[model samples]
Target: MSEKNRDGKRSARERLAAERAKQNRAEKRRRGLIVGAAVVGVLGLAAVIGVIAAGTGGDDGEASGPVVAPSGAQGEDSLAIPVGEESARSTLTIWEDFRCPACKSFEQAYSPVIHELTDAGQLKVEYHLATIIDGNMGGTGSANAANAAACAQDAGKFVPYHDVLFENQPAETDDAYAQDATLFELAGKVEGLDTQAFRECVEEGTHDGWVEKSNEAFRSGGFSGTPTVLLDGTNIYQDRSMTPAKLKQLVEEANQ
Candidate 1:
């Protein structure tokens, strides 16, 4: 072989080796990132579990608020009140924090229309209670409100109490539900909801664990905030342009 030809071959071999080294490093970085993300995801899940466990296993004395799972809930982590026909064509899953002002606003703006659809058997609503504000604002009001709502459910009055609670939701920062008589007082607005049993359920903080679990489910649902409304698994408020008429239209489209 000629000297120039030999040199050219050697240069080509070097370039090939360099390219292989680059590819190897890139592959390693990609795998490292994946592992890092896995670890982060695991940690995030653990944190959620811890929060949920706080409701059932942690020291009751240390609990920031009341904690008890509601009886007859759909599951340990969910309390569903069907607001329409059993075989309704559409299901609206609502994840809401009672102390969230935005949720209250959404209720005030769209609840009337929601009622119309549900009453007509065009839609069913599955309400999921969450306590994002309690976690964020460091209080027990959200949990209390959720628990009271669940207690009302126990009395077969979930729908009415649900309406009344949102109708009376305090400012996000008010934490008004934490006050001693507030939850029961809200119940008074819902006929037949304020009674000895209902008062015990509210005062004793019956269903707090369910509230925590529901909030945990909300966190696990991969949603961004409270008042997360989903229509057949599609997020309806991703753009946040909310109106009762628009909601009715969405349900009609879904039904069609």
Candidate 2:
């Protein structure tokens, strides 16, 4: 080959080698990113577990009294009131306060889709009650209402009674829920929920300690505020673009 042709061929070979090296470096970077991401995910999950364990382990001794979790409550420390089929493929965890207007708004906006998804056996909800409003607004309404809901859970009418509470939710400052009568009257809206046992449970605040404990869990979990909603462990409510329709789509995709 001529000298010129030799140089051209050598340049072509050099270009090919450079391209291969670049590709190799890119692959290595991609692999590193994936491994780093996996480590971060694992650490995040471990942190969540640690928070939950610490919150409910009762080491703080803040929520005084017996931790009387409601019957049928599930999950860590029996703090979750589960709604929907257990076999559902996806789980939506909600941390809410009965006295929270934002929580009421959340229920109004998403309960329909939630009900539809639960009814279709595509999703299950683990409701975690919080009493942040009581502390923030200075009243026991949050705790009282949550106890009543737990009583309703005992009667197997929690869903309807829960909706009833939100539908009849009083103003943030009213503290109307502080009265056992108000809770009972609301429970009356749900058939079979206003039984004598439920009445006594609400009147006596049967699950007050449990509600307090759950609220402690919420506080210690590093959550921002009420209606902290999570879909399959992701904080979906924090996503400003989220909507009921989008939630439905996500649940459906997860099922698929």
Highest-scoring model, lDDT: 2
Off by over 4 Å in 2: 1-60
lDDT of 2 by residue, 116-175 (tens): 999999999999999888876777899899989998888888899999999999999999
Per-candidate local distance difference test: 0.80, 0.91
Q: What are the root-mean-square deviations of the candidates from the true structure over C-alphas? A: 12.8, 18.0
Query: What TM-score goes with each of the models?
Result: 0.70, 0.76
Q: Per-residue lDDT tens digits of candidate 1, residues 1-256?
A: 9999999999999999999999999999999999999999999999999888864453343434544555555534345645677678889988888888889888888888888999999998888888888877878898888888888888889888988888888877898998759887888888898999988887787776667657766777789998898888888878557567787888898788
Judge candidate 1 at residue 88 and give its lDDT: 84
Candidate 1 vs. true structure, TM-score: 0.70
Q: Which ranges in model 1 have alpha carbons more than 4 Å from their true place?
A: 1-72, 75-77, 240-242
